[model samples]
Target: MKYIKGIFWLMAIACVIYAGYTLHSCRQRLANNPMGLELGFQKEINQTPVVLQSIERIGQWEFLSIDDEVMVDTTESHLLSPDDHLVRIYHGTLRLGIDFSLCDRGWATASGDTVSLRLPPIQLLDRNFIDEARTRSFYEYGTWNVQAKEDMYNRARTRMIQRAMTPQNIKQAEDNARHQVEALFRSLGYRVVRITVGRSS
Candidate 1:
């Protein structure tokens, strides 16, 4: 019975010594590095301006696309010969949106969970929208020269632009851009996003 009791006492002392050594080591580490027990949350955000910078790196952001078809006909008359008539149908796609390259340094600002952005005005993304390969000669009479066909193509392109690039279409594209931008910011942890569409100074 005495031997068992002695063994138990030795085990207890060993446990106490181990606990004391652990506590002392912990104290020493804390003394050397005072912020070991920091319980506060880190509230500073580092991705505030990175969002805009990333967007600026995207060269052309297309928000809207309009498909248009235009028919143009031209006729050349000669007194001694029959009139040469050429009718063509042109297909084009008009892409409209903000050019991120135009975004200024002060385009985006963030405060807490709120982000404000000043984006460049939405405009036609590409002027050469016509698909020349898709141009179909609807009707042709007699032989047409290259210049005549070129003139008809120009007229067709102009008509398509006029028909597709209206004020209503532009407004729709702007609205879409706002929604897209808001969604992007919200996904990036921004709760409130304010966007303004205008020419950046």
Candidate 2:
């Protein structure tokens, strides 16, 4: 009876140790996650407009004439150095019109309208550097030892999930992209700008 009791105590102690070890391993795995993954900006410039207007008064006859607005639309390609990221800008055409109204108080109202100034789809400026960095990091630290291979794998996977799929990481990437666009627009004289990001994969 005493022997059986001792055996029972031994088994309980072993189970407790195993459980503690597993919890400690899991905690350690959670600590090795890397943070921050962001790509550069991919910008597309659409159209630039130039307007010409003329007004003249001759022999008591008032005349106002305006030429069609000119638009320079061209694709501009930019490549980021060191990262070899590619960004293409597709330019669109601009449309210009005018509205004129006559008033009873010897006054007139004239307004110019400009339309069709838009941007093309901005694709990933570059992802080669990001891919290479991830690959190298994985190869360097994702190796395994025969004795602890399984533990290492579990830890690595946990770390990858924590690093790659964390809500904070997603938010950071989106914020970075939005800031890039905001800055681009600001440079082009957009004083009040709003940025919105959709869900990413």
Candidate 3:
């Protein structure tokens, strides 16, 4: 009976140590990047067929951003007269998916009641998704002889990319793809669907 009690106490201590370590690691991860996944749920996907071609777009997101910039013309050797302070508004869309043109083969295969599939990683489908017509200068002041407006366009693109690449967006796209692919296989009468993605395999 004494031996049994000792064994139980040792097990309890081990469990407490493991739980404390897990909690501490999670806290440190959150402190580093609250949205980043230290371990991705799953990864892996790509390649497809005509049916995939029908999906012209997936994981579409529209975002609006405003940036304040100051361009100084150092060539003018002016303290302030040649500087332009500009506020610009950007309207953009981000799409995540596989490109049909890039898919040389189909992702789905079946043998009897079981089906298997491999998919390409979800990628940024469109980098030139900004609507220039919708973008406008919100506020502008000072000189015309300063820096060109080309940098402003680049800035807008950078901001849009940052907003679109959040962990939530990537996870949502992966979840959507999983559901869609599973449904497609099920519709074709596959009783067993086995999917291998990333390290989750």
Error of 2 at 194 (Å): 2.3
lDDT of 3 by residue, 1-201 (tens): 999999999999999999999999998888887565466665766566545445444433222222222222212235856654666676776676554444336566789999987665666777676777777777667544324466666777776677776667666776777777778788989888875432111
Per-residue lDDT over 1-201 for candidate 1, one digit per residue giving the tens place of the 0 to 100 score: 999999999999999999999999989887887456657889986765534344333578788998988888888898999888888888899998999888889899999999999989888888789998898989999998888888887887788777777888888888999999999999999999999998422
TM-score, cand. 3 vs. native = 0.53
Total clashing pairs for each candidate: 0, 0, 5
Candidate 3, residue 31: the lDDT equals: 80
CA-lDDT, candidates in order: 0.87, 0.38, 0.63
The local lDDT score (0 to 100) that residue 94 gets in candidate 2 is 17
Off by over 4 Å in 1: 1-58, 199-201
- Runs in model 3 lying further than 4 Å from the true structure: 1-77, 80-82, 101-106, 142-147, 197-201
| Full candidate order by lDDT, most accurate first | 1, 3, 2
Among these predictions, the greatest TM-score belongs to: 1
Q: Which ten residues in a row have the lowest lDDT in candidate 1?
A: 49-58
Worst 10-residue lDDT window, candidate 2: 94-103
lDDT of candidate 3?
Answer: 0.63
TM-score of each: 0.68, 0.24, 0.53
Q: Candidate 2, overall lDDT?
A: 0.38
